[model samples]
Target: MAYSYYAYTPSHTAALVFAILFSITNAATVAQWIRYRAWVWLVMVVAGFMESLGYIVRTVSTKNPDKKGLFVAQFCLIVLAPVLMAAACYVIFGRIVYRVVPVESRTTKFLWVPPGFITTIFVTCDIVALLLQLGGAVLVSGTQPTQSNVQQRIQTGKNIALAGLAIQIACFGFFSIIALRFHFISKQFDKRLADKTTDETTEDEKYIMVNETQRKVLKNWRPLLRVINVACILILIRSIYRVCDFALGKSGYLEQHEWPAYVFDAAMMLPTLAIFVYWHPGKYLPYLGFRLPKSRRENL
Candidate 1:
């Protein structure tokens, strides 16, 4: 017989904790975006905002696990929000890659666009899945018995969302590999250029010092890029963890146990916020040359 009601007490509480944290993080990011006029910061803020809403639904489910309607809302919004955040990371990093990589031989000026397109497609699937599951759950709730068939349909819609996440993960892995490879290439190219600069150093000492100083400023970029890259990778890891949660026979941790539920809520949401806090690239965004939409510029 199909199981009825899903959720654990501790897990629900954990979800609320994550909810509050992300809400604060998003609000701060929104403030930063207004000050800086950057689209990427806006994207991150929106994702965190949506995640907070999803967590609110999970908090509701703590009281009534049988409220499958709320359960679907909790799953759909919370689960999909981070992918949007990851996409923001991809765009910001790609733009940096263009600026940081030595121009003479840079091969990927447009690297960010394709990933953006792919993420947009994946999110579209998530939107379709969310509507289907939310609508289906609402339909299931009205029926007296809420037949097994309805449950199965609800689960199927979730699979669609899960499928989108899975594909997005693969996209992330691809981007990670590309980012690492690009870093290595930048290193090699910079090394050769450095050697040439050293050899060409003139008897006139002032010119060499200027070039060396510029080199130091460029080198400072590596550490910051690494921090941003790691943050993005952390989100990818959380997505993998989520795939394990949903992809496994639709294992509702809410149905089988509480620990997995808490693990997911606390482990997954915390790092993204931490990353956003650490890399707060609000200052460097002037390099993007992105004009704020008229409304945003006017707001400031």
Candidate 2:
């Protein structure tokens, strides 16, 4: 039997709609990057581009489902795009630490890793996962569906992809812990600041001097953090879905049904992009080339 690129015919309407949506989001992300020059949103721009292109190729796949090249291209783009988005999330969290947390607290470290290096650590893990998934996607896409050993090759590829996803999940888990820790610590710090007497000369008060505008910006960090946490949960749900989808093999119900992919992956990721555009971090964080207000005591 010839290899079936899709168990059910791909939906042209759905693919085209998603392609357009992602394109719009990508354009918006580019605009945000141009306006703010924040490097983190640039990562989101690339992910959005990949998503748009993937759906475009998927639209083509609806017409030419048996074309291995189209299948491979869409597979690679859609699978790898989220990894980049996840990296953006990591970078955003690091920026939040720098922008909101007091210099005194973060100067030492946050969760055993310096605030500056958070992006480096998580993104390095993301890169490793991306490469692994890419390799697995190629292996799976290249296999001849009718070969006697086809099932075995497919299983090998699935295992590799699963391994990459496992790493991503682990990273998210650890990152969440760090984020929650920071959240609680910041909350306590804020409370202490609120309770301080005007005449008190505590270390925190000395270090936390900021203009009214900067203080307002710092106050709004919680909303951005909540948005990020929501995005993280959606991505985690999608990741878990992918794991189950692959574990069931080619004959699995997920592979046979088209709706599940749209519901679990497409629907989930669309909002992830939309939320960022709506509550863009650039609006809250200082524009590129500007630093958050430095500690007044340090200047003296």
Q: Evaluated with lDDT, which candidate comes out highest?
A: 2
Give the alpha-carbon lDDT of every model.
0.56, 0.77
Q: Please, what are the lDDT tens digits per residue for candidate 1 over residues 43-96?
A: 677777778787788788766666667766776676667666666766667555
Candidate 2 residue lDDT tens string, 1-300:
445688887899999999999899888888877877776577888899999999999999888887889999998998888888888888888877765555566663555676657888999999998998898888877677678999889999999988998898888767866776676776756554453323333432222334322132323457778888888888888888888887887888998899998899989888988898878887666533333344422211
The numbered model that scores best in TM-score is 2
TM-score of each: 0.69, 0.84
CA lDDT, candidate 2, residue 224: 75
Off by over 4 Å in 1: 1-12, 108-145, 188-219, 250-255, 288-300
Worst 10 residues of 1 by lDDT: 291-300
